[model samples]
Target chain A: MIEIKGLVVRYKTVEFKFDDYKFKKNMISIISGRNGTGKTTLLKSLSSLIEYEGNIKVNGEITYNSQEPILFNRSTYENIVYPLRIRNLDLNLYKEKIDKYTRVLSIDHLLNENALKLSSGEKMKVSIIRSIIFNPDIVLLDEPTTHLDLESIVELTTLIKELKNELTFIIVSHNSSFVEELKDEEYRLGGNHVYS
Target chain B: MIIESTMKAVELLFSFDSEIYTIIFLSLAISLLATATASFFGTILGILISISDFKLKRFTKKIVFTFMGIPPVVMGLVVLLLITGPFDGMNLLFTKSAMYIAQTLLVLPIIVGNIIISSEKTQKKILETATTLGANKYHKITLLIKEIKPFILMSVILGFSRALSEVGAVMLVGGNIKNDTRVMTTYIALNNSMGEYSMSIAMGIILLLIAFVLHTLLARFRGDFYD
Candidate 1:
C-alpha cells in the first residue's frame, strides 16, 4: 500500500497539484489526463525521478517504466536482465521466468538481436518485461501502450492481468478503453471526477 | 598554385620525410594525452553539474560556455605568463608540458559543456526511474553515464580533434623547439618559412588523414547502449 499527501510539483512558472490519495495493494489505479497536464510529471514524482513537495508513505519497493522506452545497445535478453543484475538477483533463478515472459510477449525471437534495432512496439514490450522482472511491490508505467499495436496491446493487457495478483500496477494512459479494461478506480484530472 | 602545392604535398608524403613524420607522431601523442585527461575530468564534472540542483548551476554553466569561446592565442598567452611568472618554479614555460596545459584548458570547457547539455537533457527521466526503483546513488550515476556514453564520446572526440589541429596556443607555450616540442602545425609553419613547402604540405596531409581515421574509428565503435 502507498499513500500520497499534498503532492506539489513546481517546474519553472507552472505547478502541478495532486490531492491526497491512497493506492491499495493488489489493485490497479489508472491516472488519465491530457497532454502537458502533468501526467508524466506526476508519475515521475512518484518514481522519485523528479523533485516534489509531498509525503509518500510506502511499505514496499517501487519500479517505474518511462513513457519512452530506454534501451541499451545490447541484445533484448541483456536489456531484460539489467534490472536483475542491478538488484543482484540470481540469474539462473529468473531464467525460466524471463523465457516465459518473452514467449508470452512474442519477443523470444528477438532476444538475441540488438535491442536498438527492435520496432517501437517490440521495444515497449521489452521494457515492460524488464520492469516486471524486478518484481517490485508497485509498478508505475507511464503510457505503456503508446507504441504498441492493437494485437500487442491486448497481449500486454492480458500479461498485466496475470501479474495483477502478484503486484500492484499504477498506469498513466490517455486511452479511456485501456484504463477501463484495467483500472479498479480511476482519477480524472483537470476537473471534478465524473465517472463515465 | 594551390593545386601545385597540394600535388607537391602528396609527393612529399610519399617520399616519407623524417622530420614530418616526427612532428605528426608528436602531435598525435600529445593531443591524445591531453584529450584523454580533459575528457575524463570533463565528463565527471558535467554529470555532477547536470544531476545536482544548486543555486550556482546557471552561473557555472555560463562561465563554462564563455570559456569555450576563449581564443587559443589569448589562452596561450595567459598560460605563457602564468608558467613564466607565478609558476616559474615548475619550469613548464615554453615546454611540451605547457603546451599540454594550454591545449587541455582550451578543450576541457568544450567537452564539459557538450556532455553537460546531453546529460541534462536525459537525466530527469532516468534519475526518476532509478531512484523509484531503490537504486543507490552509485547505481544511478552508472546508469546515467552508460546511457549518455555516446554523447560523451562525441564530445571527447570533438575535443580531441580541436586539440590536435590547434597551433597558436601550443606554439606560444611549446616554443616549437626542433626535435622537442615541435608538433605538426608548428613544424609545418617552420618548414614553410624555410622554403620547404613540400614538407609542410605533407605534414598537413598527414594531419588531415589522422583526423579522418580517428573520426571513422570512433563512429564504428558502437556505444554501450545506443538505441
Candidate 2:
C-alpha cells in the first residue's frame, strides 16, 4: 500500500498539487489525465524520482519503468538481468525466469544481441521484463504501452495480470484500450488537481 | 634539407643512444604519472559536478571551463611561482616533482571538461535508471563510473598528449637539466637551440611514434562508447 498527502511538485512556474489518498496494494491503478496534467509527474513522485513536498508512506520496494526506457550499452540478456545483478542475486537461479519471460515475449532469439540495437517495441518489452524480473513489491510504469504493438500489448497485459496477485502496479498511460483492459481503477488527474 | 634531416634522424634512431632513450623514458614517465593523477581527481570532480547541485555550481563550472584554456607558458609560470613563493622552504623547484606538478595542472582542466561534457547527457538518465533499480550509493557511483569509463579514458589520452607535447611549463619548472629532469620536449627545445637539428628530428620522430602507440593501445578499451 502507498499513501500520500499534500503532494506538490513545482517546476519553474508550473505546479501540481495532488490529493490525499491511499493507493491500495495488490491492484492495478491507472493514472489518467490530459496532456498538460501531471500524470507522469505524480507517478514519478510516487517512485521518488521527483522532488515532492508531501509525505509518502510505501509498504514495499518499488521499481519505476520510464516511458522510453534507456537500456545500458550491453547485450539484451545482460540488460534483462541488471536489477538482479545490482541486488547481488545469483544469475543461475533466475535463468528459468529469464527464459520464461523472454520466451513469452518472443525475445529469446535476440537475447545475445545488443539491447540498444533492438526496435523500440522490443526495447519496451526488454524494459518491462527488466523492471519486474527481480519481483519488486510495487512497479511504477510511465506510458508503458507507447511503443508496444497490439500483440505485444496483449502479451504485456497478460503478463501483468499473472503478476497482479504478487505486486501492486501504478501506471500512467494514454493508451485507453491497454488501460481499460488492465486497470482495476482509474485515478484521473484534473489539470493540477485530483478529480478521482 | 628536409630529406637530409629525415635520413640523419633515421640513422641516429638506430644508433641506440642511451641519452635519447633516457629522455624518451622520462618524458613518458612524467606525462603518464601526471595524466594518471589528474584523471583520478578530474573524474571524481566531474561525477560530483554532474550529480550534485549547489549555489556555486554554475560558477564552479565556469571556472573549470576557463582553466581548460590556460596557456602552457602561463601554467608553467604559475607553477614556478607556487614552488618559489609560498612553498620555497620545501625546495621543490627545478625537480621532476615540480615538472609533474606543472603537467598535472596543465591537463587537469582538459580531463575534467571533457568528462563533464561527455557525461552530461547520459548522467541524469543513467542515475535515474540506477535509482529505479534499487542501487545504493556505492552501486550508483560504480554504475556511473562504468558508464563514463570510455570518456574518462579519452580524457586521459587527451591529457597525456597535452602533457607530452608541452615544453614551456615543463622546461620552466624542470629547469631542463640534463640527465636529471630532461624530457623529450625540453630535450628537443634545448638541442634545437644548440643547432643540433638531427637529434631534434629524431626526438620528434620518437614523440610521434609514442603518440601512435598510445592511441593504438588505449583505443581498444573504449568499448561501444562511440555508439
> Candidate 2 DockQ category?
medium
- Let me know the DockQ for model 2: 0.76
lDDT of 2 by residue, B126-200 (tens): 889889989887888878888778888888998999999999999889999999999998888987999888889
Q: Show where candidate 1 strays beyond 4 Å.
A: A6-19, A32-41, A174-177, A187-196, B1-8, B218-227
Instruction: List candidate 2 segments past 4 Å from native.
Output: A193-196, B214-223
In the range B52-128, model 1's lDDT, one tens digit per residue, is 88999999999999988888888899999999999999999778899999999999999999988988888876776
TM-scores, each model vs. reference: 0.88, 0.92
- Which residue pairs in model 2 clash with each other? none
lDDT of candidate 1 vs native?
Answer: 0.84
Question: What lDDT does each candidate get?
Answer: 0.84, 0.89
Worst 10 residues of 1 chain B by lDDT: B218-227
